[model samples]
Target: MKNALLIIDMQQGLFHGPHIPYAASSVLSNIRLLIKKARSSGTPLFFARHTGPDGSPFSEQSPLTQLIPELDVNVEQDSIFIKKYPNCFRDTVLLQQLKLRNIDQLVIAGMKTEICVDTTCRAAFDAGFKVVLVSDAHTTIDNPALTADNIVRHHNQTLAGPFVSLVSTEEWVA
Candidate 1:
C-alpha cells in the first residue's frame, strides 16, 4: 500500500499552556526518526499546523504556532497544511494532497493524543485511508483528573483497539 507520514500539530503553543499529556521531548525524537525513515524510503511527508483566530496565542504569526524545534523539517521535501481546527482534514488540503500522491495508508504522529491526534485519525479512517498510529510518538500534558501517562495509555489502547493499527516506533522503523 502507498503510505505517507502525517505529523499533526506539534507546535510550541501547545507546549506553553497547561495541557494534558505534557509534551514529551522523547516524542519528538521518535517522530524525527520516523521522518528520516520516510525521507530515505521516498515516502511522502505532510505537516499540519494549527492556527487559531486573530489575537489568540496560536494565531498564524505567533511563534507558538510554529513546529517544535525537535523536528528537522525541510520545506522543500514536505507539504504543510495550516488548519484552524483540531481535525487536520477539516477544510484543509491534506486529503487532496494524499489523494494526489495516491497515499492509501497514513502513519500519524504529533501532539495532543486525545484531541488532534485522535480526531485526525478518525477523519483519515473515514476518508478511506488505513491509519497506523504511532502509539508512543505523540503526547499531551496531564489533566487535572488523570495523569499524563494514564491519558496517553488510555488513548493508545482505545484508539488502537478499534480505530487504527497501533505500532511502536521500533516496529515502524523496522
Candidate 2:
C-alpha cells in the first residue's frame, strides 16, 4: 500500500483572522512530528492551499495563501495544489498527482476540522483511496456551541465513519 501525506489548508489566512480555528497553536508540534516522519519514511508530501476568487485576499497571488510558517514548508520538495473549494480534489490536480504516483493510501493532516479536513477525507475515500486521519495533526476554531477540542474530537471519532481510519501521530510514526 503505497502512501502519501496530504497537508491541507494550513495557510496564513487561517492564522490571523476570526475564522481561525481554536487551539491551533497546540497542534503545531504534532503536525511537525508527522512531517518529520513522512520525510524520514520517504512518503511524498503534498500541500493544499486555499485560493479565493480574483481580488480576494486569499487569491493565488496573496501571501495569505502561503503555508503557515510553523510547518516550515519546503516548496521545492513538496507538491502544491491551489484549491478554490473545500475538497482538495475539486478542480485541482490532486487526484492526478496521486494517480501518477500510484498512491493507494493517504495520511491526512491539517486545519478546520469541520470543513477542509472533513471534505478532503471524504473525497479521498470516495476516490477509492484509503485514508488515515491523524487525530492530533488536525484542528479547528472554537464554535459558540462547542469547544474547539470537542469539535475536533467529534470529527476525529466520526467523520465519514468507517470510510476513514482515525489514528494518532504516534501510531502513524510507529
Candidate 3:
C-alpha cells in the first residue's frame, strides 16, 4: 500500500510561543527522522499549516504561520495544505492530494496532540485512510485541567483502537 507522511501545524508560531509543546525538542527530532525516512522510502510528505485571522499567531500575514526552520521541508518534494480548522481534511486539499498520490495510508505527526493531532487522526480514519500515529512525534502544551504528558497519553489510548495504529519514531523508523 502506498503511504504518506502528514505533519500538521509544526509552525514557527507554535514553537516560539510562551507555552511550547511538551517534549517539543524530542518531538521535533522524531518528526525529522520520520521526514528523512519518508524521503528515502519515496513516501510523499504532506504538511498541513493552520491559518488564523489577522493579529493571530498563525495569521497568513504573520511569520509564525511559516513552518519551523528546523524541519527539512523541500517545496519541490512536499505538498502543503493550508487549513483553518483542527481537522486537516476540513476544507483542505489533503484528501485530494493523498488520493492523487495513491496514498491510502498516512503516518501522522505534529503539534497540539489534543487538538489538531487528535482531530486529524479521527478524520483520516473516517475518511477511509489507514492512519498510524507516531505517538512520540506529536505534542502539545499543558492545559489547566491536565498535564501535557497526560493529554498525549490519553489521546494515544483513545485513538489507538478505533482511530489509529500507534507507533513510536524508533519503531516506525526501524
Q: Model 2: per-residue lDDT, tens digit, 15-122?
A: 555675666666778888888998999899999999888898878999888888878788899898899999999999999999999999999988778899999999
For 1-174, candidate 1 gives per-residue lDDT tens digits of 999999988877775455534547678778999999999999999989999898997789999899877777888889987999889899999988999999999999988887899899898998899999998798887767887788888989888856799999999999
Error of 1 at 42 (Å): 0.7
Question: TM-scores of all models?
Answer: 0.94, 0.93, 0.97
Worst 10 residues of 1 by lDDT: 15-24
Q: TM-score of predicted model 3?
A: 0.97
Q: Mind sharing the TM-score for model 2?
A: 0.93
lDDT leader = 3
Off by over 4 Å in 3: none
lDDT assessment of candidate 2: 0.87
- Regions more than 4 Å wrong, model 2: 18-20
What order do candidates take by lDDT, descending? 3, 2, 1
Candidate 2 or 3, higher TM-score?
3
Q: In candidate 2, residue 39 scores what lDDT?
A: 91
Tell me the tens digit of each residue's lDDT in model 3 across 1-174: 789999999998886678878998899999999999999999999988899988876688788889888887999979987999999999989888888888889999998899999999999999999999999999999999999999999999999989899999999999
What's the candidate order when arranged by decreasing TM-score? 3, 1, 2
Q: After superposition, how far is residue 123 of candidate 1 from its true place, in Å?
A: 0.9
